[model samples]
Target: MQSDADGRLTPGGGTDALFWGSLFRDLDREGSFLQLQIRQIIVSAIENGRLPLGARMPSSRDLAAVLKVSRNTIVIAYEQLIDQNFLIARERTGYFVAGLPKHIGAAAREPGGATRDDGRWTSRFAHRPSTYRNIVKPLDWQAHPYPFIFGQFDPGLFPTNDWRESARAALSVPEINNWARDLIDGDDPALIEQLQLQVLPRRGIRARSDEIMITIGAQHALYLIAKLFITPTTRIGVEEPGYPDARNIFGLLTPNVVPLRVDSGGLVLGDEFENCSLVHVTASHQCPTAVVMPLARRHALLQAAQSHGIILIEDDYDGELMPEEGELPPLMSLDRGSSVLYVGSLSKALAPGLRLGYVVAPAPVIRELRALRRLMLRHPPLNNQRVAALFIGLGHYRSHLARVGSVLLERARILDRLLPQHLPHCTWSRGAGSTHYWVSCRPGTDTVKLAELARAQGVVIEPGDVFSIDEGSARHCFRLGFSSIRTERIEAGVERLGKVITQTG
Candidate 1:
């Protein structure tokens, strides 16, 4: 049985092409082969009785066209399925589902096996991490005409071919042997070497391999450090409007979380440092506000850290994405007393999903972090670490950064020019190399309302309320990120948001 040209099933009966298409809609493309994915889809369909025994399958060419995959890929998938007895090819016609054991072919028609309604589990939990106010962005942000959301990458800027080349190299037999085994609190040596030789130098920092540890991301590094250092009596200072995750991570351990002030020069140099045992600062580029800390302030902070015996956790998450003009050294690089723990991520300029980040510190600190990390998840996937090492070693990492930095610089300049014209009612701050604008509307204006209105107009924005520890302090502020939106769309998006703002006012 086969479908007619109109794609409708004929009286002879065949698996509908529409059904086949829908079956593979949610295929995981991250780490799987298309041929294997297709084969698995067919196998699942057969096992679920969607493709009953003797049910005809679509021709290779037709299915390939529908799936938008190469003809060779479809043929390979069909041939492999046939070899596995999940399918049987009928010469000159098409393939059909093969007869299988009763257990294999039978479908459990009862959707989602019965379950008892257990009593509430919230009371059993020690902490409720979910109740924390978090930055919310639509999962379908890409579908919007203008998505000014932070920390997301524009697909066009991703280095597809270069990354694929690196990934392929990592899959080689020797490379596989290097990363396949359970590392158990260890990271890929090659990646560590690459970070030491290639990455750290850009920030004017140097470290021995023993002083560095790989993390799933900068967030994971923060968690490990917090678990090891923070106690109920420990006084930790963070920026007033700063990275919420850092504050939350610290708050979980201690109630002495202090909200420090941030001005144009970055974290204000005040007596607040005297009360802190540790301070978490995003010195390279401030989290919600992309204001770079000046060199003078960097020195002051270091001095304060040394004087007060405070340990500074520097999150250089976007350090690599800074502009060349006024780039300042990371605190880790400038510290002579070893008071700074530096955390960096390749995910900011690269892809966030990669979750490759590292912490640079004194050897003793690294040892403790490694042990804590081992208890949590041992280490980040070795395969990804190896691939990132290959990417850096091959010089693709810097080149990719150069290209993305240039594009983002242009986008930032455009925002700078357009904001004054389109949003006169609001003020914004974007330092030299910042990728986002911290925008403030007129007094008494609620940006949460503005964001809701802007989103209805197909423009996505991030309300600044979540970044504030004081809750209501940032009610009139918002953040606009240009990394995810296309350059040409910037003007239109801003203009549309301007109209929404006027309407709201």
Candidate 2:
């Protein structure tokens, strides 16, 4: 037995003594939780044969020292791996890889790698997906000094102690008995109770447990809604400059993705939506633009939907983040005809790695979706659902929400002060509360090029081209998210952005 150091293994533990820590050395862990990153790395190694079958892995202590994470973090990752069957443990010996694929071809290379055989994937498609033109921000964005990327969770805002406590509570014998089982085609009833009472009521949207279903995240929720309502013959209405991912999802199922115009008041309610079978909207804080759709407009949009027999899927993503006084109630709250289906997520307001979201619709719609969900994922993780229930049950969710709103509001104020002082030439739309700013450059400026070049300077910005259904006409717009950047970095990042804007012009 080589039991001298932390890396030592028991005699005859396994075949190879592999220390594959360098494989994750250059990986990015920004905006994501540590355990997830480590889990993903180990899974990738197993699939790629870098960690072959029966190969002994480095001890948890040694790997923790190498990765600069806590030994407990490595242990947690290992436990999850063991749970998922990617690794196995001896009674006292260190862990070893459990599974190895029969073959690892060039096709099985790292994610997004383009091998020679990759181009033929288009042949199997019924309709090709839309060509997304936006820059995919790197995952380890925290490693960068300036991150203006949208949709990232601020690590500083995570309620670690509360979440850990919630996890501990969920793992208790009684609670474990409740959440550890398959829950086949069922959700954590406690989490639904929390959502109905604590979460939805504030937004003025109320629902029964039968009317809601948990999803992998808001993205999965949106995808399911699109599958339910959209088809090749159906006309779907989307905002001109809306959430790109939503647009792409709808486009995949329908040939008609109608791009309606978005102004200061949000998506224009007009004849565009009249003929649409379904419409996707971000009414609270419009994606990309950060504009709140007015209350009057909300009523009018509902009226229009009723007249046209349209189903409106309201993505109430940022409603919880707004200041309570002036915020408009969600359209779902205002719907008397049961025409509005609401989408809400813990991922955006809490943590993306949790991949937890929910949909509120008619009970019939929920029943159908639950059947479909059973065919897809069965249900979102029982543990995540239960822990989330406790987090809300203990009031940590509301407290965390208030703290995040305060910090984002502070960041918004700082961004407002800095943007004018540094980049006076550009115009922007700032909402009462939202994570991002929609920036419109000078008449002839190419924001796409500016964004591409700014990355080289360590300032990552999201170009606006992808937000629009029509990318050709959206070259001068871009977005800056303040959620991830420190208040002190706002000025310099915008100053550097200003210089790049000037350089591009």
RMSD of each: 4.2, 6.1
TM-score of each: 0.88, 0.81
How many residue-pair clashes does candidate 1 contain? 0
For candidate 2, lDDT tens digit of each residue in 1-505?
2343544333322222233446777556564688888899888877776665776677888777667778998899999999988889988877887875555534465565545675687777676554544446777678877899876877888899999999999999999899889977889999999999999998887898999999999989999888887778989988888888888888788779898888999989777778788888898889879888899999999988888888999998877864634578789999988889899998877777889999999999999889888989899989889999999999999999899888888888788788887778889986766788889888777777887788788898888877876776667888898877877787788888888887877
**Maximum-TM-score candidate:** 1
What would the per-residue lDDT of candidate 1 be over residues 208-298, giving only the tens digit for each residue?
9999999988999899999999989999999989999999999999999999999987898788867899999988788888888998889
Where does model 2 exceed 4 Å of error? Answer: 1-121, 130-135
Q: Kindly give the number of clashing pairs for every candidate.
A: 0, 1
